[model samples]
Target: MARPAAKARVPKHLVALAVVAILGLVLVADYLWASSSASSSAVWSSRLNLHTGPAGSTPPVAKKIKEDKKSVGSTGINATFADLPAPELKWEEMAEAPVARLDGAAIQIKNLLYVFAGYGTINHVHSHVDIYNFSDNTWGGRFDMPEDMAHSHLGMVTDGRFIYVVTGQYGPQCRGPTTRNFVLDTETKEWRGMPPLPVPRYAPATQLWRGRLHVMGGSKEDRHEPALEHWSLAVKDGKALEKEWRSEKPIPRGGPHRACVVANDKLLVIGGQEGDFMAKPGSPIFKCVRRSEVVYSNVYMLDDGTTWKELPPMPKPDSHIEFAWVNVNNSLVIAGGTTDKHPITKKMVLVGEVFRFNLGTLEWSVIGRLPFRIKTTLVGYWDGWLYFTSGQRDKGPKDPSPKKVKWVALGTVCHCHRCVVCLFF
Candidate 1:
């Protein structure tokens, strides 16, 4: 009788209400557990993002990554300043150049420097060729270029053994721009002619890359008018073949005296002066004419030879007629150029600042300054050293003084650690 009384049915509404209450309690517990888990994950993420390095010191790998991302697009290649240290340059005075000259081209091959024609004393251009032997630190071998091929403000490049000299001013003080091309055999000390450039130009940057010769950025017959045309000459049978100068994409803008170098299989054109070089009033070359020299700091790179991509500009506007630049490891080291102008000093001042451009990042940084100002000098890189020889200091344009520097400054580029050891121990 008691079991039957307990089994009496409860109200349907009350039973449904009890079930809903139990479900609400379960839902509240689940939300609390999820919120706690989310908060713990947030704390973990915050800790991960707080990773820091030593005060005032860069984490080498992380810094490299950041620089690469900023300079070049994501290249997936990591480089550190520690491994490829900023070039430690040391200037040591060596034997003087045989002759004082400017606006010449020089190349280093097998511990020897072959300096080509440039302007000599009395503002006269000469065809004199001199050689500097590193083994003895002496300038001995002396030769003259062919009377016809001898010219200053020419574009020159070397493919290890052969030095290719391209178009340049003919004579009469940088008047005639010739299309003549020639090659010199270093071992035999012989010179041979090659196919001429399609159009005559002077001060165009020339380089040999992947069996082709690239010529870019120079002036036409008039030294002032910049040429925007670009041309390439192919090589066959280990020699620059005689063929038509194949036209390629023009530069973004034309300029004169732009520094050209082949680094990382890419062609880079550095700062130069824009516009034409009009003759100034009372000038010896072309008197009573207005001359406008516009300097630039822009940089452009041509990787495929069909398109030019603008890169980070130089730190300052520079149009040093004769400056030295070379590809050192992954950097383009530029040294000893006048700032903002070519004449360097109407007031007798020149720039000794040295800078380096990182190829991976396409970024430029000041490495160090030269001991003294140099312009119109031939710079040569050999065996981890840069040679700055026979350049002019800040002499007034009309000074007529011996503008050519006699001292040969050797900049031994070493790693930072090696430089430190040399300085201390």
Candidate 2:
């Protein structure tokens, strides 16, 4: 039977082919397929950006994003800033204004900067406010303030149209009255009184949070010092004057700090004069000792009133710094305040220097120094540029010349971290 099966005739080509030849062809194909697959997998992985999406089904699930809302910047920098709010710095030397101020209150609505209640000589605060238009770089004399507020650490907020000037101190003469809140309508250019602050408050850094105006620690009614009490003012009329003062969670430290901003649903308070000694005349007694700067390099973040997490403070110790005078794009910029104190210096007061902090990165870098001394005031930013209206240009007699608004582009703002890369490749 075996001999009969082997007797079948085979073609010449088939008889010449060895089993090894067939096996070799199979091996070559398998090797090529595997090599190609491995290379393709690596290439595809480089190109693949797979974010987990909903499972394949009629109803889908929403993917959870870890990032908070306030921290979102332009996705790729090419997106339109249509709905984004852009602030512009405009100087008003064209018109007749008395003194350049640092402690003034600025509010924005419809791209107009309404300035009020700044520091100057003889209790003079341009009662007649100035309105600046960033679009045309023009100034219009608007409504006059009913009262003069001097040396009052002021906090300001605008509810789309109306702006409210919140708690600040009067001066260091004696104990000052706990000032009531003043609200103004940017559109109508009128001022009215809002609900009284729950406590004697002043100079707290104020900012808008999730559609609500929040005021943080600052110099209170006692004197040129910041009180730790934090209060939030909410406006129901969409007008600042009609809002009510409701006490919110206080910062862990019960003393006024210079500036505060909202990030990650938490309030970040910068620095203030804390625990610095001062020498006085006619006696051996020292006053306002530890006038802050104790925690100059300290940073405090509050997730809630009950919990305050400490982040790295500024690399440098500057107290009572002008939070508004420094401009940072999507970051917080603050100008000089204090470093150290001596008989020659009351508290280390620095001018013209600027420091910027990125909440996302927790990074601090000195951005730029002003061309002229910008003594103090709130800083505003627009389109990666900085602008500030100085209270006093320097420690000297106020220049009678019409005050000029100063501005510096962030790229031109300074040399450090100021990137100048030409993209022509």
Candidate 3:
């Protein structure tokens, strides 16, 4: 009887309230613990500064990037090649060109390298054509282009069998442009006439895509008039000698000395000088004329042939005028051209930097610097090597003397698992 009396009845509502209060207290404690733990974890992470490398690779606890002393160009942009993955490039001296020339075009067909018309040592344009045989490593089989077809700044392209030479200047001294177009059969070594361009131009970029020849921006008849028009020509039959040129949509902006190449099935127009070069007034030297030209860092891409869309600008704002560009493994590799922004003085100098743009990532990085600054050089990609023909080195205004070059620099592209290694001497 005494034990039963001790059990006093509790209210149901009070019991329910007690249970709710306990649950609320438990949640509050959990929230506070979580907040404090998260804050401490973040603080520790910041202080630790952990870095993770590629899977299965050990990452350094700390990294110190060394500054590169070499300057990029007159642009004053400096970059270090230490952090960048090395490109697959090996450079060596090949056989010297049979002749030294500038402002010309070169194309590789099979094992033969065709060097077209260009200005020689005396600054006189020559119609000389020289073929270099890779099999024998010799330059021979010289041919004279027709008097009419002999021109510089011509847009030349090859379809693996025939070389198509398009619009160009008639002479070396900034003469009027020529509309004449010709095709040379590599098999027969015979030249034949093709349909002339709708608009005559010089230094236009020509490339073969989808069995059609695409001719892009260049200067008009007058060196001052930039050709904004674009045209394409197709040979109905592979063996046909005659073809019709059709005009496509024009480029939004025109530029002379633009470099064009097809990479990843996209037609890319690289940097070029926009404005016309004019003589500077009150200059002491004859060639001391100041250029009104604006160097472009813009890049445009044409995928449909009817529309051109601008892509990311170059890393630097220097013009690629008279530069050499090649498509290596779907990446755009540009090298050797003057900034061309300033006059021929200490400020005006050739760009010794080499830039490579990855089409997949749309990123550009300075790969390496040229052994010597060069401009208006001929660059050809054959097998796994990039061949740089003769080019002039600018000694600046004090000297204003053109340096002679005869050796052909061969850059052999070495393929690594995830990176390219470019070795140059």
Candidate 4:
């Protein structure tokens, strides 16, 4: 039975204030959700499987995966690059990941991509390791982490041969071995210990910039999101710098960690919940705001800590927009993500929508759509297309199976992971 609205109230003024507080929280949450939509999942903290082909069209031969060394165009798919009606990934019974998991971030160490640490049903955070070889299309494994680290929303980046993972939260209320930075060597398959972060935090902006691993602008918990406060770990013999912590010009009105990538020799941060950050992340929880602050898409780039300039915002603020290149020969492509309140449902743990960003023009557009409503999302880019996995993918109206099950390459990898290295020359 439903309680009557009038009789249930404890006090008048208190009720009103509570309502206002609720509204404020909802509004800010909405704003954050609106401004950012994750291409990847953010449970710890957050691409589309975009193929370089016309809708219902076929793929061409000789595809190239864009890494720091190469630049390609969307050749056979569409030279002009027109957005296609979204397609729900076809869920297949035979082609699922050998193992099932979520909250794991994939870091590419040279030709091999490793999905490190994830959260599962209960105590599902395993040091389990899955290795994929793009050249041979093989899935193998080495040893697991020395200890289990299973928070989804951590920050990570690779410098040529090694992956530097830092600042993730585990249990409730942002608990941890906070301040943990794990460095994995691809050749030895060994974990080297680095100095812990200055504080315990998750979702910090991590990237390989100017040959140093830049770890900056992240939050600890409910309170305190750090500023420009940049710290770089200089690589020695492919190892991290002597001192883990250093400082840089802090971003003024610091905000929550948005999408951080090395772009054009500069540190580029994009949309997130708070507008304070020059850059931000994509979120769907803040949908109404997405509808309201329609023009909140801004790309903030910092050059050597001296310049903070805003490149054109997205045509509109599109959250949960994933990034990839349409084909081996294509420009950078941003695809898949939804515009809806998260916890979309306990049964459905993710959002579903497909959008793309143009690296060349700083524009945003909707291309293909998800086949089914999805939750727990990730778009893994390898070879020429992306392998959308672990997520519940929408197949379409007539054939909807919420769970996306596969290791198939639905699309291509982006222009070298959002930052450019340009072997394109």
State the C-alpha lDDT per candidate.
0.60, 0.47, 0.60, 0.45
Candidate 2, residues 1-425, lDDT tens digits: the string is 35545576777788568666888899888756643432121100001011222222111111222222131222221232111111111111222233344456666565466666554432333345766654444567666775634344567665567666776655432225355667676666666776667766555667766556777666544444446666665555444433466667766564443666666677677776544222233323222233344536577887755677888777565555534533233466675454443223333334334566776678876544332233344444332223444343322111111122221111112111111110000
Find the number of clashing residue pairs for candidate 2.
Answer: 28
**Per-residue alpha-carbon lDDT of candidate 1 for residues 1-425, written as tens digits (9 for 90 to 100):** 35545577899999999999999999888755643432121100000110122122221111111111111111111221001122333333456566666577778777778888776542466687889865555787888797779477788888888888888876634456788888888778788888888888878878787788888888777677888988889974337665688888889888677788788788888887766544454555642233566678889888886788999998766665433776666777676655543243333234455677888778887665443345655666543345566555533212212222322122111111001000000
Show where candidate 4 strays beyond 4 Å: 1-94, 135-137, 148-150, 171-174, 223-229, 252-257, 274-296, 315-330, 338-351, 373-376, 391-425
Task: Kindly list the per-residue Cα lDDT of model 3 for residues 329-392, writing each as its tens digit.
Answer: 5577777675544343324445555677888888887766543455666665444444466555
Off by over 4 Å in 3: 1-91, 236-244, 276-291, 318-323, 343-347, 396-425
List TM-score per model, in order: 0.68, 0.59, 0.68, 0.59
After TM-score superposition, what is the CA distance of residue 290 in candidate 3 from its true location, in Å? 5.9
**Candidate 4 on 1-425: residue-level lDDT in tens?**
99767755487899899999999999888645532332222111002233443322111222232222122222122223212344323221112244544445566654566765554432334466677664555567746865634355567776656767776755322234367677777777787777777766555667777767777665544323444466777765456666657766665434443556665577776643332111112432211121111112456788866767887654333332222122222333433332212122222122333445555566665543433334334444443334444432333232122322221112111111111111110
Clashes of each: 2, 28, 12, 59
The alpha-carbon lDDT assigned to residue 137 of candidate 4 equals: 51
Q: After superposition, how far is residue 124 of candidate 3 from its true place, in Å?
A: 1.4
Candidate 3 TM-score over all chains jointly = 0.68
Give the per-residue Cα lDDT of candidate 1 at 255.
Answer: 68
Rank the models by lDDT, top first: 1, 3, 2, 4
- RMSD, candidate 4, Å: 14.2
Model 2: CA > 4 A from native? 1-98, 148-151, 171-177, 224-226, 237-245, 254-257, 275-295, 322-329, 342-347, 393-425
